[model samples]
Structure formats: structure tokens, C-alpha cells
Target: MTAMRSPFRDALTTALLLTAAVAIVAAIGTQLSGGTQRIIIDAMIKMIIVLGMYIFVGNSGLLSFGHIGFLGLGAYTAAWLTIPPSIKASLMPGLPDFLATAALHPLPAALAGGAAASLAALLVGIPLTRLAGVAASIGTFAMLVVFYAIFSNWTSVTGGQGSLYGLPVFTSLPVAAGFTVATILGAAMYQASASGFRLRGSREDAVAAQASGIDIRRERLIAFVISAFFVGVAGALYAHFLQVVVAREFYLKLTFITVAMLVIGGMRSLSGAVAGTAFVAFLSEVLRQAERGIDLGVVSIGGRLGLQEVGLAIAMLIVLIFRPRGITGGRELTLGWRSR
Candidate 1:
């Protein structure tokens, strides 16, 4: 018989299922109120970011606390390119003459964001990917801190913690859904490709992979740049979705949530990325509603301001304790039977 197509088949199934879930969310959002649709967009954006993280962290077996820095990079680049020149001149006068005067469509803005993030990743990955284990993770975390500081304090360029508003609201449910699907397909393809295989081999045993002629750093850096670009796309989408760009929005808070989603979903497989994002996003929405007080026919419960964070923390802890492999147990989704 010909070589079995299990892996590729499984990857396609996983991508399709992931796309299906996003489509369902988009459909449901269209049927619901505007606020609900906004929530769906937010969730899909998170899905894209988490999937982007998986493209590197999952394949390379590296924990990155710094991809959110790429998110900030993408967000700011999109703001610079896409925001109206008049608004840019008034709010971000520190922007370069070219950027301040340039206004672009959403596609170009997103591409610019991705390119900027990928460039940053290329520079950082050279040094960072050289390290291994916890050291690499810490280095990435430091990167995030550096980005946060710059964006927070760069008054002219980033609005200095003030929200940069008037971004053209271009990310509707369809746009968000399309981005999510593209991210899923891109990640799945990379995961099943030769580079992904070599990277995973390096991840499992760097010494062996190195002995086998695989340049560990090169592979890791490739994944890093690719992942950064995808996350940057998510950031651009987010900027347009909210019609604003704020430093704090792309900082630690979001970093924590995206990381949690990945961990709870399973960092080993693409399906885990999708499952984790959907699970956490749905849970988050529920907790948000609960915090705002859900009305049970007979009684109106008062809102609990911090419940969302508290619930997330508790859920993460429980999942870590019970299912450290995540909801998908690090397994890829498959269309046909997948023999153990």
C-alpha cells in the first residue's frame, strides 16, 4: 500500500474543524446583538493570536512570554499606516513624516504590521533562540518588558499609555473570521511541513537534531519569524476592531490570557490551540456575563467585579492540576480513525 496519509489528513481535518468553529461563532454573532458580535470578534482575535503562538512555541517546544511584544509592534505599525493622516498628525505628531502623512487600506496595514513584527522577530530570534530551556523563556519575557516600556513611555509615537483612537473600524465578523481561518491554515501547514518536523526533532532532543545536521537555531528562528507575523496580523485586526490602539491592551494582561488559552488547550498540537482558545474564550464570555449579574428567573444576582479574572485563574489551575496535557491531551484532530 502507498504511504499512509494520516498526518496530512489529520492536519487538514484539524484546520477545517478550527475554521468551522470560527464560522459558527461568526454566524451566531450575526444573529445576536452588536455587543455580542463584538465579543465574538474579540474571541476570534484571541484565537488568531493563540494559534500564532502555537506555530512557534508548540513546534519548537519553547515557552514564549514575549510574543505579545510582537502584538504591540503590529498594533502600532497598523495604527501608523492605517489611521487617517489628520488624526495621526494630531495624535501622533511624533510619527515620521512619511507615516504621518500615509493612510492605507486594511490589507496593506495588516501586511505592514506582519512585516514589522516578522522583522523584529528575526532580530530577536537570533540571540534568543540560541538559549535553551527556561533561559530562552526568560529572554523572551525580557523582550516583552522592553516592548511594553517603549510603548508605554514613547508619548509621541505610542500615545504614552493614552489610547490612540480613530483607527478605521474595519474588522467586522467576516474579516475576523477570515483572519482566523487563514491563521489556522497557515499554522497547520507549517506544523505538518518538513521544517516543522525538523524543529520538533530539535525540540525533542537538540543535541541529536544538531548531530543530524539540523541547524536548531535556524529552524527555531524560522518558526519564530512566522509566528510573529501571524500574531502581528491579529494585532492589526484588533486595532481596527476596537478602533483604537493602547499600549496596555497589548501588554501583560493579554499575554497572560493568550498563554493560558494555549496551555489549557494543549501546546503540542494545532487542535489544542483551537480548542483552548474556544474553551477559554467561551468561559471568559460566560464569566463576564456572570460578573455583570445573570438574572435567574426568580432572582437577579449582583455583579462581581473581579470574577472574570478570578474564574480564569481558578480554571487554569484546575486544568493544570488535572489535565496538564490540556483539553486535547496534545492530540491532533483527525477525520478518519487514527490508530494509537
Candidate 2:
């Protein structure tokens, strides 16, 4: 018989391995051209977002189409806190006294962004967590729509539909990699915790979990808030990276892509989350290059607009057909020495 490892040991091993892998990628990115580096940084940010979604969807078997809304909230919050006072005053004159005059650093702004998202998640999760299955999923989508509408129309706070710029560009390869490692560790630890177990139990069998004294709603709520915070932080990083915040960017397209990454990688496992994000990001980048037209020695091919989206759709369909459980099959990446 194989011996079972402690949760802490398992989590630590997984975190260490993932961190090393990310570090290697980041290192390579530093030597690449500017465009490639941007792709790597963007992928790292997406990893954070996917991992955040995994915290809730993986453990609770709940699908949330609205988590990207938290990302938007985080981005806007960061913009509000970090944009220069003069810029804020002119660009968003409807701002309150404090936000108009405030110009905090990116680090603190990122934290505040996460806090804002978490608070919003808590407020929405109160009623949302009570729902189950498709209902819960739909509820979350509604939440996203509501956030999009508010951000698009609330000129005073969110600058309405206009893009909010002037954020310091602080999210480089190192910065994104650092946050990605932290997110990986946080996700692994959370998955190995008691709450994670309870949540998973409920996911597998809600009645049995409730009978065993698990408060389903509370567990879901906890995961929801924690997940929001992570995605929110990713949002802040994204804002700093692009130095701009746009409500449309956080809407349907992003929501679909991020959720697809989680699903294609296996939403049930953290390893799957990372794997899926990396796979899709690489594939998307390749398709983007193709869309711009690739030149070969004999024949030239490319210049296909919407190739990225179409390619992603086809890839997702293929994965669903052959590997419905995702590339990882809902399993964590582990050393061969361990036995399940």
C-alpha cells in the first residue's frame, strides 16, 4: 500500500514545483523581445485570474461567469487610487474629494483593489451562494452584467465608458511572476485547508456534506470572497501593465476566455488551471500572429481576422470531445514518488 502524504506537504510540493516553472518562463521572457515579454506577463495575469476562479468553481462545483466583474472593480479601484491627482481631477471631475486628490503607489492600490472586489463578492454572495447549479451560475452572470452597467454609466466613480489612463506601468515580467507565484502558493494552501475539503465535499454530495455539519452556503461564500480577492489583484496588475482601464475590456469577451481557460484546463484542479491558461495563451498568441499573416518560403499564409477566436473555439471543442475532464483530468501535478 502507498502511504498518503499530509495536505501541507502536498500543497508545499505543488507550490514549489509551480513556482519553479513560472520562474523559468519569466526568466526566458526577459530575454525575449518586448512583444513576447508582454505575452508572458499577460499569461501570468490570466493564470492568477484562472486560479482565483478555480478556488470557487473547483471546490464548490459552482460556475461563476461574473468573477471578471471583480477584476473590473479591482482595475477601476486601482485607477482611482493610483492616477495622479491632477489627472484624476481633470479626467474624472465627478470624483469625490479624496479619490480626486489621492495618488497612492501601485502596491497599496493593488491591495485596495483586492479588498474592494472581496467586499463586493461578500455582498453579492450573501444571496447568490444560496443558489445551486445553473441558477447560481446565472446569478453570477447577472452580477457581471450589473457591474458592467454600473461601470459603464457611473461617470463620477468609474469614468463611465471612457478609458481611464495614466496608471504607472509597473507590471513587468518580474512583478507579474512574483504575483503569479504568490497566487499559486495561496491557491494550493487554500485547496489543502479544511474549508477546501468541506467545500469539495459539498461539491461532490451536497446532502451528505450538509448532513455531516458543513454549512454549504457559508463555505461557498468563503470561497467566493477569496476567489474575488485573487482575481481583483490580477485586475490591478492588468491595469498597471496596460496603464489603462476600460469597462468593455472586462465584459463578455474576457469573461468567456477566462472561464474557457479554467474549463479546458480542468476546473477541478489548480494544476489544471495553470496548464489551461498556459496552453490557451500560447495558442492564442500563435493564432494572433497568423492573423497578422505569416510568410513562408514558398507560399504565404495568414491574414485571417478572428482566427484567434475561431481557433480557440475549435480547440475547446476538441478538448471537450477527447478530454472532457480537462487536460489534467482534475489531478494536480505531483512528484512520481507520491501515491494517491
Candidate 3:
């Protein structure tokens, strides 16, 4: 049977398409306030993370608990490349012979970081893919922990707990929006590719897919690399976006937030990526604002407690209780035009 397209799907797709367009135009429009600009920028960065999720989790039905490692890898890679060569020598002594010898441009550095992350994922994916079910899950989690440990301990390269600062902030709203567009198109293309189909097949039933001549390990690795690459890109943006890079930024907690986006949006769906990211991203902000408490002028309370903890718990509860399959439930963004 052909893939069914519901009205809801059409509407969701159209809305996101319009949003991408509007964001692009706005990016080119007159400069926006810093806070407003930051919101859009944050959304765009999150777009990359969500798209990465859509690739591996969506196509292959794999749940990676440590995908943030790619973000860490990308951030560190970019930091090393983009940082002033003089700064590098002082910060990262006894580094890779090539790194010490070579200097990098921002664009090239971003590409290199993405490539490095994908390569790293490839190496790691080989052995990890051999395990099935929860074994794979735990293996990946361990991988994340290991990566975090390395980042924390590898002072010279990553700068350890201290933030990697002094990155020239080249990431503007327009650039971020462009990246978001690219991310959407890339994820869409991956979803429709032959390899994607094979990966999905393996995801649905690895044994059956193997019987049909599919190399599950190869397929998983491919997905892992692709996902890692995008996540790496997201890391580049995040480093520049915050004007710094830190190990904690890509820890298990970041993984949890990203996983929440995938799970609440619906695993194995492109539309779900957008849906989950939009809803979760926006909701998180709202909860944060609520926790912070709006200024009434008359009085203000709840200063001692940050709403983030409670907000996160509530968000998790809402998703698990009401919409278990996630908000999108594996849908696609199509044509549902709504005028404001």
C-alpha cells in the first residue's frame, strides 16, 4: 500500500515549510533584538539536533542515548580549528602532529569537525551495531559516558570543564536559518534514499533484513555516520551561538533533552522531528519563563526554585501519559496552509 497522507500531515508540513520560509526572510530583514534573535537562533540550532535524531532514530529505529557525543566531538573539533593558532599552541600542547602543524578556516573547520565526528561514529558503530536490542542501547550510553569522560579529562584539546571561549561569532540568524533549511532538506533526502529503506527494514526486523542480503552492521554504521555528521554541524552552531564550548553542554542531560524531542515527536518520522523539536523547544521555554516568573510589578515569587526540574518532569509525564507514540507519530510535513 502507498504511504497514507492525512490532513493533519499535510497541515504540519505546510506550517513548517512556511516557517522555514519566514525565518529565511526575517534573517535577511532588518536586524532583530538580541533576545528575539536568540530565540530563532536557538530554534535553528535545535533543528540540527532534531534532524540528526530523525536520521538514525527515524530511519533505523535505533534509540541512541549518547548522540550528544557527536555534538561534543563537533564542538571540540571546531574549537581546535577555529581558535587562533597561537592560542591553540598554548592551550593544547602535545596535540596531534597534524593539528599542531595545520591551521583551519571556519567553514573548513566546521566541515572537518563534522567529518571527524562521522568518522568517529563509523569506528564506534562497527562494534556497537553487532549488539541488538538493549545491548546496543547500553553500549551507546557507555560510549557517551566515555566520550564525556574524555572531553572532561582531555584538557588541552577540549579545554575541560572551563569553556572554550574566543570563537569569532560568525553564526548569524540568516546563517543559522540557512543551516536549518539545509538540515530539513538533508533529512528529507535521507528518509527517501534506498539506504534509508534498507536501514528501516533492518530496524523493523534485523534478522529478516539480514536474510534478505542486508548487512545490518553496514547499514547501522551508515546511519550513525550521517546522524553524527549533522549533530556535529549542530555543535558548530552551538559553540558559536553561545560564544563558547564546554563539556557539560554535550553530556547525558543534553542527550535526554534531545531524546525527549525524538520520543515525544515520534521515533521514525521526519515530521516528528519538526513536531517534537517545535513543541518541546517551545514548551521548555515556556516552562522556563514560568519558573522564572513574569514581572507583575506588584509581587513576584518562586525565585528560590528553578522551574526547569519540575517542568522537565511534567513534560515527561504529559508525553508518556497522553500521547505515548509521540505528537507526530511518524508523520511527514506536507501542505496545510494556515494564514495568520
Evaluated with TM-score, which candidate comes out highest? 2
Candidate 3 lDDT, 122-205, residue by residue in tens: 999989988877888899999999999999988877777777776777678877777777777777666666787789899888
Residue runs of model 3 more than 4 Å from their true location after superposition: 1-31, 336-340
The full ranking of all candidates by lDDT, starting with the best, is 2, 1, 3
lDDT of each: 0.90, 0.92, 0.77
User: Residue 247 in candidate 1 has what lDDT?
Assistant: 90
Query: In candidate 3, which residue pairs get closer than 3 Å at backbone N, Cα or C atoms, i.e. clash?
Result: 13-333, 13-334, 58-268
| True-vs-predicted CA distance for residue 87, candidate 1, Å | 1.5
Candidate 2: tens digits of C-alpha lDDT, residues 1-340: 1223577787788788889999999999899999889999999999999999999999999989999999999999899999998888877889889889888999999999999999999999999998999999999999999999999998877889899999998899999999999999999988989999999999999999999999999999999999999999999999999999988989998988898899899988888999999999999999989999989979888598999889989988999999998988888787853432
Off by over 4 Å in 1: 4-6, 337-340
The window of 10 residues in a row where model 3 has the poorest summed lDDT is 1-10
Candidate 2: residue pairs that collide = none
User: What's the best-to-worst order under TM-score?
Assistant: 2, 1, 3
TM-score of 1: 0.96
Against the correct fold, how does model 3 do in TM-score? 0.88
Model 1, residue 109: C-alpha shift (Å)? 0.3
Candidate 2, TM-score vs. the true structure? 0.97
Lowest summed lDDT across 10 adjacent residues in model 2 is found at: 1-10
